[model samples]
Target: MPAPNAAAVPVTADHGSATWRLIKAESKLCLRDKVAPLWGVGFPLIVLIILGAIPTLREPVEGGGGLTYFDFYVPVLILFNLAILATAALPITLAGYRESGVLRRLRTTPIGPARVLTAQLVASFAIALVAMILFLAVAGLGFGVDLPRNPFGFAVAWLLAAAALLSIGLLITALAPGRGPASAIGTVLFFPLMFFAGLWVPIPQMPPVLQTISYYTPLGAGMRAFQDAYQGNFPSILPLVILTAYAAGCSLIAVRWFRWE
Candidate 1:
């Protein structure tokens, strides 16, 4: 009777069965969609290969504590994977669903638009997790990069980073009018975010001013936490706090503004 913004049916044992189906369907769609796989997984994996083959990148970074360039890149590329999935893959698909009135139509169904949103988030998280493990495997076995020294800390940081990035994607979807604008917004956000994550220049090598700015950025803080894990320590409190703030703030804004049509 109402629209996409309507309150969802309360969850129950049977309702959760529908939830599983939606997530499974979305996972299939995520795989079939060429854009996400190509950029999120394929491109990063390809770059890892090329970077690994370069002998010079194995040299110790100028100010990267004790890490080599290649070692530094392993985590950065992992960040690349998450960024692509969150900014490009997640927002584009959801905006397309809205533009095509798929979300609007869901209001009349037992599984409402909110459930579809949950499914999309689950699917994106699954893909990003796979890509993360794959990248770690390739970098460790193929390139001889060391695994994260603090494995548990690394995982915590990664999951928090994913939550924050996914929330940003949702915010983009909320603000963009259509699929075109969503893609445009995602692309616009991608490069600069990666830059602050130390894609082009290692954070240790950045000028003091830029490094200061990077500390506050979402990916930058995530990278800082990742580096801590890489170095065999738990992430410091400041970066964790910053990441949590971003995740909470962006999710609140996205939930408020998101429209089904």
Candidate 2:
């Protein structure tokens, strides 16, 4: 066997075709990872269903702006699925790839780390979209939760939220020493994000100071945008700016510090 030359791999190519192939390959790899689907799709759906079954949760509440708890939960679960995929599944997979020398091996081939990273990101986005659809379908049919009243606004907020969370995942993967460390760091961030997203306490019910701070967390800003869209209002500029800041700031730092090995 002969050793491969790092610089021998050509960078130029029909990027469209190459990127599509890379996405397809990453999709297959994602499917093979049982944990991704379990946490990203199944667990969230299961939680939503269980929560929706609560009698009190199914009833409309006055303080909830005339919507049921289930309605509020619809967006919560939507963001929750993406958050799990971004924080828990993505960083672990990318870090593990590096740990297993897959990324290093690709460096000597025509396929480079940038392509693989983009492919993984695209594939993860696709999976999260599927999970979102599943949650909407199940929630609508099983719990009578209404779809977002402002579809376009909902979509914009959703994209911003996804970008912010995915950027954080990349930053974690870039910084962690190994896959285990990456997973631990992601898990540590997840609980706080979820809390601010109103998993344990609705934003309206939180103390004034906590509510102020929650608006600044990525998931908090996301949850606000999602809820606003659900109420047929445009997501406010503040949440949009917050989401953009997290996405751009984390992505910049991640790319600047990223290491192939």
Candidate 3:
């Protein structure tokens, strides 16, 4: 009888290692893409400058108990930047990769599709984290924004927001048919969702009907949670609950509907 073919045995460990290697490669490609860094970091900083320049936002509070508008707005700005970057970049890049057969080509390798997707998510989160830190630094040093009283609370809020937005982005990537359609849908979704986020206008100033509507939107709830952190107030637990539910629901939907092609 022929000698047992030891080499023929499937090496699951090798597959796991190869999957991670492919993930790293995909992350590098994403980082090298010029637009990702710009939108992720540049546009948000511009908004920070505009917020700092406003005379009303710069004025110090009389009672000294509350932060100025600039201080109030900085955390919201950071959250907004994270949401926009993750949602916009993930869908577009994933769709483009799928359309171009980059994801498909990986099927022939030891790397699995899920690993590739996870890599992209991780890469985006890493970039967003860096952008957020830089934004805080600039807001504090350049614009005189105050640090949050409860740093742990602030960190928790940021992580929750990232989880919620990243889930939505993944859902878009999995469900949207093609690059063009994904881009079109993302474009339509981003601005309207962001407007309710209180980035462009304060939520209190919005009409009663709109206020009620905004309460249900992810961006709005996220902004409220973030605002509470900035002002050193306790965040509403309800919004965090809502965010967790949304993330769970979106992730489930994405997994069920994801298309490799």
Task: State which candidate has the highest lDDT.
Answer: 1
Alpha carbon lDDT of each predicted model? 0.86, 0.85, 0.77
Query: How well does candidate 2 score on lDDT at residue 249?
Result: 90
TM-score to native of every candidate shown: 0.89, 0.90, 0.88
Comparing candidate 2 with candidate 3, which one achieves the higher TM-score? Answer: 2
For candidate 3, give the lDDT: 0.77
lDDT of 2 at 48: 91
Q: Which rank order by TM-score, best down to worst?
A: 2, 1, 3
Per-residue lDDT for 1-261 in model 1, tens only? 887766685556765688798999888888888767777788888988899889899898776677788998889889888898888888888898888988778767887545666787788888788789999999989878899999999999999899888888878877676889999999999999999999998888899999999999999999999999988999999999998999889888886776878
Tens digit of per-residue lDDT, candidate 2, span 5-41? 8678757565556768889988898899877788888
- Candidate 1 global TM-score: 0.89
Clashes of each: 0, 0, 0
**By TM-score, who's the top model here?**
2
Residue 195, candidate 3: Cα error in Å is: 1.2
